[model samples]
Target: MRHSLPGGTLVLHPDELHDGEAGTEAGFRYRMIYVEPVVIQQILGGKPLPFIPTGLSTDPRLGLVLETFMQSIDAPLERLEEEDALFDLAQALDAVGNKRRGRRAYDYQAAERARDYIHASNGASITLDELEYVSGRDRWSLSRDFRALYGTSPYRYITLRRLDLARKMLLGGFNLVDAAMAAGFFDQSHMNRHFMRCYGLSPARWLSMLGRQTCTIVQE
Candidate 1:
């Protein structure tokens, strides 16, 4: 289908059947961000997914949301900035949509306990069953709640926490292998895969950027 996506227009829930093509001979340039539904779920706090009746919206609030999130091609998002943006975007989305009720209530307390457990075990291998025990919820329910509240699966949450620790170690001049091991990854290669997926950069490249960022801070 031929359609125009102006600045600030969003196309959410694009399934496998959807594809895009340029309408003009000059072609189009755009950036696509792939967000896991769990991320939105966390921010929306179990509210049904917001339905934007038409795929296109010129709502200024959503425009601000998109602007806050989309970054330069090679830039890394600071943790706080990303979280704040998601919160605002979620609020805006929730306010615009009609309410729908879920069969089961969202369990914020259990999910929070699981999150705290993950934080405490950042450098250890944790299983779903283990989280189930700690959070006092069944394995399946805990898993679902965790993602609904935290924007990631329990396994992925652990990996991200490890990567955060590894980034700190690397910034402190530790070798990649040591950092990876200390952060609880099985090996450097294992860390490398997850790091790239999370940061859109290899460890070496991220380190290089970190160095430049540090230098800029020192100069300032």
Candidate 2:
């Protein structure tokens, strides 16, 4: 029930329970595409769903196409381009469905405890000693396992969590200064630097784009 998936894995769940846990030591960021059953029926000409025995794949080509499909969602691409990307992704997935590979096992319970503590803190500053106390792992081991499982260091993960909170506040009509402070940043400039580095754009610019997009949708 609590299987650990490595990075670059793709999963397909068809008409079954697909449950996962986050805020754990092995938590990960991922992209998901949902295809309706009607759409699947049309694509398969009313045939049964493709039987992907294991429902998992680590094919590099499939990963590349999946990444392209994800980027097409946000990129300023034409509708046809997006469709092409999706088609390619589907084909790549079909090609890898029958292939099998071994799964890797890992033990990171202490690191998971640290991750849970970090989430519970809710953007507050966390110390290494606190993590050690909560997780029973030394700073070095915690840091190593945390990065291995979550793909980021503990300090970076904390900063990313604050950034996420600040982004949400900004989208919910909070001003820059308020969002920054409430998300645990020292000030607007502090949030600005990290936000720009992470998103490749300033908050003001991103917000402006969002406003324009909303206006366009409303007008249309």
Candidate 3:
């Protein structure tokens, strides 16, 4: 379940999923967006990531900053309100990661096709040969583009995306094997390997860490 939460109740971090039931439960609702940590730094008048002295989100100092942003979504007043909103979002994220003073080193656009193709196919075994067709670049060039743009090869990128989907599904209470299969992994082992690689922890351990219980749904 998810809703915009006045944009005030949001304690979002980049790439973090913010889910909750909306004000009135008309139906199951959700809102999904990627909030990058750098956006926060940008809003702090070009300030770098502040020294919050703690890495955990639950830190009271971090909580205060986040609470300020979430609880005051519509409070800031400015002529250029859009700009203010962007800045506000940045401030919120800066509570987590500091902005890189220099230009960001990642070319996020280069991986669009690769990302789309992977998601479109439900995380199938994506070969460079196939990506060449989808992205209109040769294998060698595609590999280069992926690494140069996203800091990882296409294969690794796909694997990571699969892991992301698996994590989301598991968090939503999907069975591990079913989540793996739905994410285009060959089987549970495939999901486990990628999950471990991406998280440095097993799927079950991840669930425990996240305080999620075993899923009841078993997709056929």
RMSD of 1: 9.5
Q: Provide TM-scores for the models.
A: 0.50, 0.48, 0.46
Candidate 1, residues 1-220, lDDT tens digits: the string is: 5366667465577473566777778888877666676767765655567777656566777776666567624454434335545555665676555455455666899888888987998668776666778888865566556667778666667778999999888888778888888998877767887799788988888877756322111112
Clashing pairs in 1: none
Model 1 residue 7 CA deviation (Å) reads 32
Query: What's the TM for model 1?
Result: 0.50
Model 2 has a clash total of 0
User: What tens digits encode model 2's per-residue C-alpha lDDT throughout 48-145?
Assistant: 45445555665687777676557656654333234434444444555566433234344499989999998998888777768879999755456546
Task: Give per-residue CA lDDT, model 3, range 12-55, as digits (tens).
Answer: 43354534454775654433333455544433544654543232
Q: Which of 1 and 2 is ahead in TM-score?
A: 1
Report the number of the highest-TM-score candidate. Answer: 1
Screening candidate 2 with a backbone cut-off below 3 angstroms (N, C-alpha, C), the clashing residue pairs are none
Candidate 3: the clashing residue pairs are: 2-29, 2-30, 8-70, 14-35, 39-90, 40-90, 40-94, 49-98
Q: Please give the ranking of all candidate structures by lDDT, highest first, separated by commas.
A: 1, 2, 3
- Tell me how far candidate 2 lies from the true structure as C-alpha RMSD in angstroms: 18.5
